[model samples]
Target: MVFDDKNADQAQSLREKMSGVRNGLKVITLASGKGGVGKSSITVNLAIALAQLGIRVLVMDADFGLANIDVMLGVQTKHNLTHFLRGERRLDEIVHIGYDGVRFISGGSGMMELLRMNEGQLSKVMHGLTKLDMPIDYILCDAGAGINDNLISMILASSETIIVTTTEPTAILDAYALIKTIVKRDNLHPLHVIMNRAESKKEADHVLDGFSEVLAKHLQKEVNRLGHITLDPEVPRSIKRQTPIMISAPNTSFARDIRSIARELLELPPQKEPGNVFSRLFSGLRK
Candidate 1:
């Protein structure tokens, strides 16, 4: 397989930067096989839930083409990731604090540029990320849907990848494709699956069971079922109000499920304690 030298250099520099950071901030990249799978909402609520547990969390709206985490949280952004990428603003300056103590950085129109960055540009971006001074326990990356070079790169860079999907057959197929692509590339990082908009617990279990069986039988990859979110009327109401269900309707089924998922993630073995994130990511990328 042919490799791009610039991409390689960029990866190496990112790995070095990650290894140099001493803090154990868990970087979680939430991705999906297709759009309209509720990936961003899960990311927003999960970050808020984690923050409620007293864990400092930051969300990066890396969806690029269709970024909306800021809008969802009702926090208007004066500046976004574009400003930081252009060296016009620092990461702290662009990070917008939102409801429930969760912070976010908007992707704006600069997401495509982020994906297509060459080695030098990518290195600068990585350096800026490492320079962030927040005492963060988690950094949730809301990556764009599907398998793209940018999506795959960010997935590999993160300490964990959370794959979100609904019970839809197409969505499941796409999720499988996404997992297959990642495992074929590198399977060192842990993968977590979440079923959103599930009608019932039994249905969610059945869907994930079939999905898991396919991976184990064909791809030889294992994924942890984080949990599922039931379809709730309050979810849409909360979204329309620009509030998270965890904050708006805390007692609702959707909110409770998200909180449960947050606890599960916290209970998982932390990747940051093992080594520098960059070292671990680089090792996976180079494989």
Candidate 2:
């Protein structure tokens, strides 16, 4: 989208607002290099799990491929980044509240082409994030799977990233490639990994160990093993019901596993000034 003179000035104003938005604000981008690894699903449940522990969380659906989070929560997003950029809605006003008060923002839809936005469009959206007034401990971005400038930009802009992958060989390799790409692009980019749909904890541990070794050996990068989610039949059932497992079956092992990952994520310190983006929404404190 070409920004007119007035739009350019407004975007500049939003960028200026970003200067005050980084009071320990934590923005974590969740992604994968391959699809069908349940990245979006985990994004939804993990946000809810964190909220269950009283950590206010906002989940942004950056997965331009599809609004899986929306379908999972059975909620329709009437507004998105475009709306916020148009001056028709505040960034916070476009948020779609999901399970357990976990706020979400749709990444546009249909012709909106969320991922295809130009640099100026993306800059405006990123700057507008500071408009959010509600207190939030974490802003989890469920980035669309695979490699692209948009995906990489989102990850690099966030404080850190959590890459989700399954036990499949292709999935593991793709995850590694994605991580290596990030490190190659910016050696300091913090990254973590989550093994989804593992058959068993033993296997999960084995795979994580091997994967960690590969990363350390090849890329000289250290990525935390956030945790794993084992295969669960109920996960599909919950999806069919349009309710996340964290809400439909919080007592189940699947939900408990998500909570474990959330706890690990809580222990991570927020970047002092993540990419100099996301100014503090609160005066002196955030995150």
Candidate 3:
């Protein structure tokens, strides 16, 4: 599994894209229209895969009400994101480094705490988060399902959003609904889809086709397919073992799929400026 020169060059380009941004953070928020679609599973392993490729990754368990990255990763830390949010500790102090060298912050069943954050507290928490000194290459926010204010804010602030869904009709319809809501409400960031628990390649293609059809016909938005993860027993086995499938069953079908997805993600071209030279020059001068 050697990364050739081309792959290395693309990874470097991606790093450069993050270099100009403050905090060196490329935030990727993972959301779902509904649960039971393996959203958290994808988020955890994706972060692990990136880290395995020598990228500094952080999984912010932003699921808020139902955060479970810690359990999935077998982390039994005392502190959580709420503790940092409440100013009880620093972000680094609460982050639990996993076996794969990925760092994660637990969401901590802090239902009331998250719901009660006043504007001032929220501002302080955001400020604290910005102050984290690690050269974080990516901050993967695993957001809970549904359309909520917090979820919307996460999507808006993220550099990219990965919407997870399955081939089921209900899941596809709900995913389209979520995409429609994001376009209507935020309408600024790019969104990608990941078809999870897909029974077959054809089913995954069908899911992506349906999503694209709906978004194009109704919302007039062009959504990108980030690829799909097949349904594999290793996923549940790893879950029971409290370890990531990428580590526990790296050769399994789903693990191979995830690795392919990770490689594809690494090969993605950097976001290009959407203008000619003169426009870019003017925009740069304005900045």
Candidate 4:
């Protein structure tokens, strides 16, 4: 097939622009009102699924108190976020590569100490992150459940916040409560939802509807429904194997759903400017 010169030039220009802007590194923070809703599972598989589409993804396990993305992904720990926090290593040194080309930064055990860092340390960490060499397409922060200050900081910094919840009434209530807090605290609008462990589409819809209604009526905000993962046994089995469902059981329905969600997220228009020379230069100077 003959290539069109005009199209080729346009493609090249787009690539140049993307390279200049750092290629749209979107930061998506996943949080839950309560634990046990498979937040880490979703985060891991979603990263893998996105990477399957040739998108470079980094899953940052931000659940400081009880971090386990490393264990779930079966990545043996040589070093973790603690090393970076303690200035023993740089952020890039701690990244662990996993299935389907996903890279992860393990949230070291007892990282609650890092949370106590004075403003200077926190600023240093943030500055360090911007200087990393990897051109990450997405930085998925799997934050701890609840509305603590750390979690709030993560939510505010992220380009988008995904709230995972199950069909239980308590889960729904907590999800609403968390969104309400975010709205009031940040003065932000709707928060995204990922309904997990639903038995059917109807069940997922019910869960989404309940949250949407509350947000609309009570908070005067809209809750965007990203999608849902069904009650698939393959999920837990894959977790037990310490592998992502997208890699361990790609043919399973749960894997299919994960892939679908990844596609949806990828297809969404790029939100943040990927990279800029000024930002990179300043980042380098700060180091």
Computed on alpha carbons, the lDDT of every model, listed in order, comes to 0.80, 0.78, 0.75, 0.74
Model 4 agreement with the true structure over 1-287: per-residue lDDT tens digits: 12245333433332233233444666788998887887899999999878877888888888874789988887777898778878898889998888867888887776667556443444454445545698777888898877665465456555678899999888888787778767765555336788889999898998688778878898888867778889999987887899877877887768777777776676654233335688889999999
Ordered by TM-score, highest first, the candidates read 1, 2, 3, 4
lDDT score for candidate 1 against the true structure: 0.80
Better of 1 and 3 by lDDT: 1
After superposition on all C-alphas, the RMSD of every candidate to the true structure, in Å, is 11.5, 11.4, 14.9, 16.6
Superior by lDDT: candidate 1 or candidate 2: 1
Looking at model 2, residue 271 earns an lDDT score of 27
- What does candidate 2's lDDT look like per residue over 45-121, in tens digits? 99998898788889888776365678888887788766776678988788877777889988765645564676566
User: Candidate 3 residues 66-163, lDDT tens each?
Assistant: 68898998878799878777778887899788867888888887577776554345445444544577767888888887766556555655677888
On the 0 to 100 scale, the lDDT of residue 167 in model 2 is 83
Predicted model with the maximum TM-score: 1
User: Which stretches in model 2 have alpha-carbon errors above 4 Å?
Assistant: 1-20, 85-87, 268-287
TM-score between candidate 1 and the true structure: 0.86
In candidate 4, position 261 carries an lDDT of 73
The number of residue pairs in model 1 that clash at the backbone is 0
TM per prediction: 0.86, 0.83, 0.82, 0.81
Model 4, residue 69: C-alpha shift (Å): 0.7
lDDT at position 250, candidate 3? 75
